[model samples]
Structures are given as C-alpha cells and as structure tokens.
Target: MARVLIIGASKGIGLETVQRALAAGHTVRAFARTPVRLVGADTSRLEVVKGNALKTEDVEAALDRVDVVIQTLGIGLGDMLGPVQLFSKSTRVLLPAMEAKRVRRLIAVTGFGAGDSKSSISFLQYIPFRLVFGRAYDDKDIQEKLIKASSLDWTIARPGILTNGHRLGTYRVLTEPQDWHNGTISRADVADFLVQQITDRSHVRKTPVLVY
Candidate 1:
C-alpha cells in the first residue's frame, strides 16, 4: 500500500478520499485545518495533520514519506466571489515538494469546467457554470497549467458535478475533446478513480472528464 498524502482532507472530496484510501489498506496522511473524523478505522495508519495548505511550511511538512499526493482543495461560493487562491497557491507549494522528494505521482480533482474542457461544457450547464463555478475554475485553469509544465507523473481527474452517491466504479473516463460534455459523477467514484491513479499509468499526465 502507498503512503498517500491527501491535501484538504477535512471535508468534501478530500474527506471521502481519506476513507477510500484507508479501506484499501493505504496509509493516509490527511492535511487540513480541522481534524478528519474516521469511524471504526485503524488510526495507526492514519495521521490527521492540522494545517492549512495555503501555508508553505504546512504543505512542505506534509509531503514527508508520502507516495501519492491527491489534491482536493476547494472553496465555497462566498470565498469564490471574492478570491480563489487555494488551487494555484497550494499547487505551487506541492510541485517543488513532490519534485524534491522524488515523488512523481499526483492525482488532483479539478472538475469538468477546468482547463480546455471548458469548451465542452454543454449549453444546459453553461449558465450555472459561469454564474457559480467560474471563479474557482479560473484558478483551476492555472493549476492545470502548472501541473502540465511539471515533470511529475500526474493525472488530472476532471469529474462532472459531484454528488454523494455510492461508488459505482463504472464511471466513464472521457479523454477526447469530442467526448467531453456536461454530466454528473459521485464524489465516491471520483475518489475511487484518484486511488487507482496512484499506480495506474493509463491516464498519467492526462486530464479526463469523469462521468457516469
């Protein structure tokens, strides 16, 4: 099992990924400001480190002894309307640390409207995309550029609108521009895909729009 470092593990997709990794027997180092709540699990293999990823020292310290880094940093609408620095800022810290530690694998969740895939967002989803997710995704666009420029083996999983459904494992991994479009995918399934990317090279250095 790999020693996985999950940035922003207090809630959302990061929180779910923590449980997914632990259940698969991987040692999880959860980095966040608040503690991760785990029920009836092995704490020996789980380390909940309280720290903000925006702080350089906190992220640098968390990179220790980690095999795969899964970045699930996110922000609410209130923060998004003003400024969204979490994605680019935290990612800036991660790149050099991963390179320095010789850790090459990274799986980051960016969502469908991120990167060039923005062109593929269906008309039905475009209004909400622009009104709600525009700011956050703009930073994600920067985050993607940074990751692509790096030499690390990275897979950017751009899942469609995230829900709290069970992991179906049948989520489609759409790679081509023609295939990219608006859809829905569960946080659990996205976590499943992120865990698989730790050792799988099928989508390495590639961003696929994951959906059901």
Candidate 2:
C-alpha cells in the first residue's frame, strides 16, 4: 500500500479519509492544527502531525516521503463570510512543496460550486448560494485554477451538499460537464472515492462531480 498524507485530517471528510485510507492499509500522515482527535488505540500506521497548512515549513514537513497527497482542507462556518484564503493560500504552499518532494499525485476536495461547476448551479439556488457560500467557493475557484495550471497528476473531486451519512460505496462520478449537478453525498462516500483515487488513474487530470 502507498503512504498517503492527508491534510486537514481532524474532521469532516479529512477525518473520514484518514479512517478509510487506514482501513485500506495505506500508511497515513494525518496533518491538522489539532489532530489530537485522531489518536486512537489502533494507530499503528497512522502519524498525526499537528501543523498549520498555510505555513510553508509546516506543510513541507507534512509532505515527507509520501507517495500521494490528499488535500481535504476546510474552514469553519464562522470564517465563510469574510475574505477566505485558506484554500488558495495553502494550495500555493502545497503545490511547490509537492513538487519539491516529487509527490505528483494530488486528490483535492473542492465542492460543486467551485470553478466551472459554478455555472452548473441553477438560477433559483444561485441567489442563496451566492449569499452564503459565495466567498469560500470563489477562493475554491482560484484553488481549482492553480491545480489545473500545475503539472501534477491531479483529480479534483467536487462533492455536492455534504452530510454525516454512512459510506454506501455507491455514488455518481459525473465527469461530463453536462452531468455536473448538485446533490447530497455522505462524507464517508467522498472519502471512499478519495482513497480509490490513490491507485485509480482513470480520473487523473479530470474534475468529477460526486453526487448520490
């Protein structure tokens, strides 16, 4: 199994990915500002590294000798309104670090309204989406552009409305622009896809919308 570095490994999809990847027998370095939550009895192959994703030194340290990188970084709801730079800024730090380490495979979790997927948002839902998630999603747009512009073997998984549901292991991987639409998906299922991408090259250089 490959050694996987999971950024933002404290909670949400990141935490789910850590569990899923470990269950799949991949050694995981769980990076987060406060990853104490990840300490468990069966942490034999898990390495919990507490660090800020925006710090160059911190991110570079987390990228050590990993075969693949899965970035599932997220910010709290409180930071959604103001100017959000976590996604873009950390990505700026991430891409070059990955290059330095020669870790070319990146599985980044950007949501449905990011980049071209913004165009897929319906006219009715567009207003509220703009009102609430506009700022964060805009930064995700920048994040997507940076990844696309890079030479890394990248697969962007744009999951729709997230929920705390169980992993059914069944969801739509919408690769075509016409099939890109928003719907609810479990964080576990998204993690399932992320783990699958560590070896699956079919979606490399492709951004697929995940939905149920």
Candidate 3:
C-alpha cells in the first residue's frame, strides 16, 4: 500500500477516490481547501489536509513522502462561464512540487474533451460543448500538455460525462485514439481506476479514455 496524496479531495471523483483508496489500504492524504467536507472518510489511514492546490507551498507540503499523486482538481459550475485557469494553474504548482519531492507517479483526472480527445467530440455535441465547456476544456488542454511535458510517470484518465452512479469495478480503458469518444461513466468507477493506478503502471505515460 502506497501513501497516495489526492488533490481536490472534497467532492466528485476526488472524494470517491479518497474513499476507494482508503478501502484499498493505501494511506491517503486528502488535500483540499474544504477537506472537512469529506464527511465519513476513514480516519485510520486518512490524513485530511486542508490547503489550496494553486498554492506552491501548500502543494509542496502535501507532497511529502508520498509514493504516488492523483490529481482530480475541478472548479464549480458557477465559474465555468468565465475564463477558467484552475486546472492549468494548479498543475503549474503541482508538477514541480512532485518532481522536487521525488514522487514519480501521477494519475490525473482530465475529462474527455481535454488534449487530443477534443478532436473526438461528436459533431452533434460540439456546439453545446464548446459553448458551455470550451473555457474549462481549454485549460485542461494546457494541463494535459504540462503533464505530458513532465518527467513523472503519468497516466491521464479522461472519463466522459460524469455520473453519481456506483462502481461496477468493470469499465473500458480506451488507449487508442480511434477508440476515444464521448460516453457516460460513474465517478466511483473512475476512482476505481485511479486507486488501481497507485500500483498498476500498465497505463503509465498514456492518456486513456474511460467509459462503461
């Protein structure tokens, strides 16, 4: 079991990963601004650290002695309309911190529309997606580039439309560019993949799309 530091551990896939990682027997440092929001998290192997992801000092402090880092950072819907920089800004802080701390493995959650996956968006969903998610995905593009350009052993998990469904423990890991497309996946299932990556390096240095 590794000491896994999960960024953005309060809600969504981050919270789900926190739970799943603990259940998997990994020591978890749940890092977030409002980490108390992680209600019912197992305290035995869980170290809840409240800090801002975009802060260099905060991220460096959180990276201490961790074997792997899983970044699931996100912003609220209210901020989606404006120019979004959370993903890129946080990555800018996180990557160097990980390298400095010698945490070589990183499994980051970037959605389907990020990086080359943007080209996989169907024509039908393009207009609305661009209208609503363009700003956010644009920053994710930067985030992907930054991660790719790093020296860390990284696997970028790009799940499609997110849901609050249960973890089925079975999902597709689409590694080929031709297989990349939009679909729906539960946050729990995505976290299942993230926790698995703590020791499973089969997907390292690849950005695979996840779906049911």
Candidate 4:
C-alpha cells in the first residue's frame, strides 16, 4: 500500500478519491482548507489536514512522508469568475512546496479547456465557456504550462463536462483530439482514473482528455 497525499479533499472528487484510496488499503493524508465530514472515512488510514494550497507554510506543513501527491486544488465559480490571479497564486504556492518536500510524483486535475483538448469541446458549450469562463481557463492554461515545464513526474488529467452521475467505470482516455463530441463524465470516475494513474505512470508528462 502506498502512502498518498491528496490536496483539496474537502468535498467532491477529492473526497471520493480519499475514500477510494482508503478502501484500497492505502494510507491517505487529505488536505483541505476547511474540516472534512466524510462518511465512513477510516480514521486509522485517513489523516485530515486543514490548510490552504495558496499558502506555502500550510502546504509544507501538510507534506508528510508520502509516495504520491494528487492535487485536486481548484476554485469554483465564485473565485474563478472573480479573478484569474487566484488560480495562479494557488498553483505557484503548491509547486514550490512539492519541490521543497522532494515529492516527485504529482497528479493534478484540470478541466477540458485547460489543455490542447480545448478545441475538442462542442461549440454550444464552448461559446459560454469562452466568454464567461475565459479567464479561469486561461489561468488553468498557465498553471498547466508550469506543471509541464517542471522537473517533477506529473500528469494532468483534463476531464470533460463533469456530472454527479454513478461511476460506470467505463470512459475513454485520449491524449490527442478525436472525432467524438459532447462528452460527459462523472466526477467519481475522474477521481478513480486519477488514483489509477498514481502508479500507472503511462501518461506521465502528458495531458489526457477523459470522456464517457
């Protein structure tokens, strides 16, 4: 069992990833800005650390001895719509902390428009995303570029439109563009895919687009 650290585990994909890792008998250290209230979270194998990813001290303090680092750190509509600087600041802080701790393996989660797959999304969805979510996506672009340029073993998973549906465990992974359009994937499945890549390492230094 690997000792894993999941940043931004307060809710959503990060929370489910923590549960999945613990169920697989791995020791999981979950970091979040606020306290987590996950059901059936194994206290013995799960350690919750409250800290903001934008703070170097917080990240350094939470970086205990771990085999892999999975970052689900992101800003929602409020922060995303408000300012692009928020995302840049958070990512800037996280990279240095990981380097300082000598943590090599890093897996980060970003949405579809963040990478080369941006042009693959449908026009209907892409219209509003380009207008409203433009800044956020640009910030993600910068963040991804930094990760790609880093000397760490990192893989960025760019999941298509996220839904709260059941985890069918069946999805398509593509490194380059495909002919398919209008893809929707569950957040749970994305988390599962991220955990799988923790040790798989096949797509290291690559950004893969996931769709259901």
> Which one wins by TM-score: 1 or 3?
3
Model 4 spans with C-alpha error above 4 angstroms: 179-182
Cα displacement (angstroms), candidate 1, residue 116, comes to: 0.5
Compared with the true structure, the alpha-carbon lDDT of candidate 3 equals: 0.92
Candidate 2, residues 3-26, lDDT tens digits: the string is 999999999999999999998999
For candidate 3, write residues 111-150 as lDDT tens digits. 9989999999999999999998899999999999999999
lDDT values of the candidates?
0.89, 0.94, 0.92, 0.82
Query: Estimated TM-score per prediction?
Result: 0.96, 0.97, 0.97, 0.93
Worst 10 residues of 4 by lDDT: 174-183
lDDT per residue (tens digit) for residues 1-212 in model 1: 89999998988899888988888889999999987897676678899899888777887788888889999988877887877878998899889988988888999999898999998877887898888888899999999999999999899999998899999999999999899987888888998988888778899989999999
Query: Sort by lDDT, best first: what order?
Result: 2, 3, 1, 4
Clashing pairs in 3: none
**1 or 2, which is superior by lDDT?**
2
User: What total of clashing residue pairs does each candidate reach?
Assistant: 0, 0, 0, 0
Local distance difference test, candidate 2:
0.94
